[model samples]
Target: MCGTEEEMREVAGRICRNYLHGAWKTVEPQALGFRRISRVARRSVLRSNSFTMDEPKKVLLRIYGQVHGERAMDAIVTESVIFTLLSERRLGPKLHGVFSGGRIEQYIPELSEPALSMKIAEKMAAIHSMDVPLSKEPTWLWKTMGKWTRTVREERLSENIHGKSVDFEKEVEWLKKFIATVESPVAFCHNDMQE
Candidate 1:
């Protein structure tokens, strides 16, 4: 986390400049012509990373990082991987470049809240309808959940709270069996919608 708003802006600007320059260096001789990014007002659903627009290039840059001890739940998949796939299908923003902890993407201007909702629903349906890549691995949801369940069970057993009889093993087994019975299909989803 940054100590101040100014510090955050400085960091974002550096990242954005590096990304754009690196991406264009080989092809374009002209400088990036970057100006300072104007910070947008934070909303409930927005990530702590400030939204900035490139006036010269007409692009959007998103700087990703930990905020208030919370990190993105991109355990098995990274944003670059997901966004690249979505970009190929023209389902999401066009990715201009990716940095170490952030990415520069084509920015769409925000619409009114109600109109945004409608657009999001339509886009999500379109995204879900796309065929998964033949080379991509299966969804990691179930595997990650099962791993967490075991870890929780181990922690509880280690704590040994008195008068608490918890059969986590049985619970996990039952949960897995229950989940197997359900017809939940793995679809392309923006797991972190708040971003």
Candidate 2:
């Protein structure tokens, strides 16, 4: 379920109450210019309003089952990867805090054209510099991809396609094989980065 304005305000208030308790402050909820998925709390840039905070301060909060377990895991992994990159000064944004709920990060608001490009380049460089240790353990990428592909195929199959057939399994297998052949040095990856 999507959170209403009241719910969002409540969440923000709770964040302030729990983390910034007794600190000098005012809590004002401003609409952010982003589309957020309530399920995973994923935000994507879209045409919306912008909220200005007094300052971008970090706060920590708990993550309940409301957010998917896999999303939680992904957040943890992303935080760790970004932390290593930022410590080396290879990324633009600095991490403010990592809490049970999620991570808070800060970025310099003002940037010239050249500086922005430089920052992007630095982020890429950091990712390329990571050393990904080899593991005998199973990787989830293939399984996750397979599931995604299967879902797509099932959706297509359900659509009435007269006198037409698709080899869903074969296609999925080919894609899996192609993915397995790709090998690259591990680097810090944002996986998700946008305004």
My TM-score estimates for the predictions, one after another, are 0.61, 0.55
Candidate 2 weakest lDDT stretch, 10 residues: 42-51
> How accurate locally is residue 87 in candidate 2, as Cα lDDT from 0 to 100?
48
RMSD per candidate (Å) reads: 7.6, 6.8
- Candidate with best TM-score: 1
Task: Report, for every candidate in turn, its global Cα lDDT versus the true structure.
Answer: 0.55, 0.49
**Number of clashes recorded per candidate:** 0, 2
Report the lDDT tens digits of candidate 2 across residue range 30-66.
5322234334543221121224454443332223334
How far out, in Å, is residue 1 in model 2?
Answer: 10
lDDT string, candidate 1, 1-195, tens digits: 234645554555555555554333232212233333444312111112223343224455555544341234443245578788888777777776776655667655573377887987787888767776533443365566666767877677624558677676677678778978998765666665433
Query: Model 1 clash tally?
Result: 0
Compute the lDDT for candidate 1. 0.55
- Indicate the residue-level lDDT of 105 in model 1: 72
